[model samples]
Target: MDTEQQRFMNMKRRVYKIVLPVLTVSLGLSLFMSAHKGLLLTINLILLVGMLFAWLFLSTKLPLRVIEWFLLTLAGIYLLTMVVQGVYTQMLGHGETSLGDFIVWMPMISLLMFLLFDRWPALIANLALFTVLVLPAVPAFPRLNPEQNESLILFYSGIVVYTSLAYFLHQLYRTRAEQNAMLRFAYVDALTGIANRHRIDTWLRKKVELGEETGKLFSLIFFDLDNFKDINDIYGHKTGDDVLRQLSKVVGEELDHGDLFGRWGGEEFVVLTDTGEEESFRLAERLRKALEDHDFGIAGRVTASFGLSVNRPGDTAESVVSRADERMYHAKQAGRNRVTGRTMVSGDG
Candidate 1:
């Protein structure tokens, strides 16, 4: 439900990106062309085509090859040509556009290029080339004023456009960065900063098909802090939490990025390792001893017992987890602060 809502909002955003601009331009042009000859109507038609082409090029699932580039290039060329034509219609004699206007419009064109190519330098270079090639022919465009102070107006106009665009881009980048950080916090454990249980579960579910396809087995290791309640009683919950925090940090730092670690519950941590018996047992033992030898200053000392189990053929996630849970209980029965592993080959009994 949340994902569906996100998609709907995203689709609405895209609709606004295209629809709002075209509609505003169309409304203004419609009134102007209603009084003038068919020139405004022609310009409006071209704008519609440009917008429709943009929607198709950006929204399609197909590869962004030369064909996509060709379409975008056409849209840019068309918009530029129409702008020039409007200027030519207004200019009757030796008219010229200000260099200021040239500067201002360059950034706008650059931004448009960014929207098209999704690369900065490439689009900036293209805009520079385009502005240089087109500026000299300003008199040929309709509705251009080649009169006094025109250069100054153009320069200021360009500055305003560029400043506005830069500000917009900066704001967008900052917003996205903040959003990404927030998402990371939500999915990560607060104390350990490792993948939380929710994330680990999601990861396993996503990879189930891949595991089946490869005929590969996966392992889960469950570890518990024995006498954790006693420690909490003697040391206080704060100290107990600190101990767990330190343990999480050490275990998290030692494991490879491919491994997933999560706080299973109070005083319990689990890991989903990609390796088999020997490697998994070695990893579990390594984590077990690291805590046994180390002393947490406030919490004094603690130990962790671990149980490992491999996935059986055609086993569900729950069944595999149950096997690991059973092994973990056995580790508790034998002694605290040790590692145990078992693979189920037969029935539930």
Candidate 2:
């Protein structure tokens, strides 16, 4: 998983960890407060015990999906019970334990619903609770005094407003996070965790434009593994991937902060540096020696060939890269691991 999803899951897990103790404490307090009332005592005791079982189930080794479903069911049933109790209190008044008054806390429950699950489950739970609460004020339902009816309507309004805001905020957060993840994924290589071809293309294009407009020099080096397919054929594809990742890491570390480096394609990497042809050639030679010297563990004794090109007065992105690619192939033809580049003469190919 990426960083964003990991962060989101960590936060959700923290909330889940807090649920059991918080519910236990809240239900215990309610039970203590309503000890003298038989119906309230019974309801609070049942909820407290249910919450206890939920906590125990969560503490077990069961699968996460099962535990999530179990917890969601517990939360849903508890909220429904609260709503039902409110409806009962509207019909037959409870001395001091008015279920209608507890409607204010429904927002907290709804918030938990959205955090624990997705919007659909939360929405269904909210609608069900809303319907139950509104029934007390409905004309077909048993009538209460005008003041009591007004209180229920106001309570229903609060629940609707609070839950709606909570849902909106949750969705907003999710959308923003998803967009960020997508943007990150678009530019980043999945295997190497560096810039991919598209990002390199964009970066080189911008640099090319800037150099052309201002006469500022920039350079590119296109390099590839020498006999890379041999590693895959001998050791297997997994070890080949490991070698690529390791090579990327070493090369990336050797680059300056102002330089842009990325995987151009399979076993081929490119580097764009803010320098002239000589410096670019030196950089490529340094990278070639680094790879030749470094041990790639299972792959062992790897080498690379490099081709270098510097930005010219009339250069485009494609032209600069093609020149570098051609030089790299020339280096490969001469020998496997060397840097080959030259200053561009007028109309030189």
Candidate 3:
């Protein structure tokens, strides 16, 4: 892949890691506080700091170093909290619990490394369960009694559910990419790399039907290479194919938005310009000259004849195409390598 595409992929990966985790963490924190009576101001501050740190860390280098640093920092915070909680309970003449709580923050710690970051669903799902799931588990960990084992079971159940859901979503993205890739291969020309004749037929039919009621205009520019068969016979078929590929590349570069280009068949192409004959022909001339100036392999510049026409009232696709094709043929007869307007050659249209 190119550098630009690689950069886009990296940015997309980073966005998924950061956005999903943060949202889940925030939601989980809210639920956790709401379900418990011990949501102290200090603990909330600690939660906010840790959550912000996790977000900041998500965008950092997701290697083991970042993870190690985060875990160590979290361990330090927990140690301090344990000491402080001890002091508070002693001052209030209440018993301080012996075992520590850890699984209460599963939403914040599901990912150990950024490199292994899953897609959005994993993080978002954990975020949603933070309070209803983790808040109630404060007294559940560290060898729970039989009565408290339900919290542990529920937490593990959530893990399985989120993992399964995350796997399903990743498959969804993968399947979509594969489908698009296959469609592109099937409907696009392999030589010129533009839409093929099949695509033109399917796409144009839909466009015509759609705009019939909307009153929008679209034009089709018929194009044919001037004396392309001679080039193939003299130079060889491979050279001829190369010339067609190069010609399509030039045409593609000049194509405007809303315009579609395709290879109709051997040495023939079509451009759906979606504009009046004047604008369509203008672009055709530009494409013709571009092809006539470029060199590919040993073959020299190539030239083409083009004919432009708009859809008439009650016009079928075949009729409009025949009219444009006739004009292209007239241009070929009058002189090869010339572009004609909407008029067809005698006995042609």
Which candidate's lDDT is highest?
2
Candidate 3 minimal-lDDT segment of 10 residues: 90-99
Whichever of 1 and 3 has more lDDT, that candidate is 3
lDDT of 2 at 128: 76
lDDT for model 3: 0.64
lDDT of 3 at 2: 75
lDDT of 1 by residue, 1-349 (tens): 4764567446644754565466446545664555533654565565556555555654664444443355446546644654454345333332534321223224544454444444455445455645644574544434444462464355435544664575468558658957987888777887666677777777666555556778676778888988899978998888888888888888877788788888877777888888887788888888887787777886666787788887666767777778778888878887667787874211111
- Which ten contiguous residues of candidate 1 have the minimum total lDDT? 96-105
Question: What TM-score would every model get versus the actual structure?
Answer: 0.54, 0.68, 0.59
Estimate the Cα RMSD of every predicted model relative to the unseen true structure: 15.7, 6.4, 8.3
Sort by TM-score, top down from the best: 2, 3, 1
Q: Please identify model 2 stretches exceeding 4 Å from their true place.
A: 1-4, 11-105, 127-143, 161-183, 343-349
Please identify model 3 stretches exceeding 4 Å from their true place: 1-8, 14-143, 180-186, 190-193, 206-217, 227-245, 295-298, 343-349
lDDT of 3 by residue, 154-225 (tens): 645765565555556666876897798788879988777788999988867866775576666778888898
lDDT of 2 by residue, 162-277 (tens): 88998899889889988998999999999898899999999998998999889999999999999999999999999999999999999988998899999999999999999988
Q: What are the lDDT scores of the predictions, listed in order?
A: 0.64, 0.77, 0.64
**CA error at residue 206 for candidate 2, angstroms:** 1.0
Evaluate model 2: give its lDDT: 0.77
Model 1, TM vs. native: 0.54
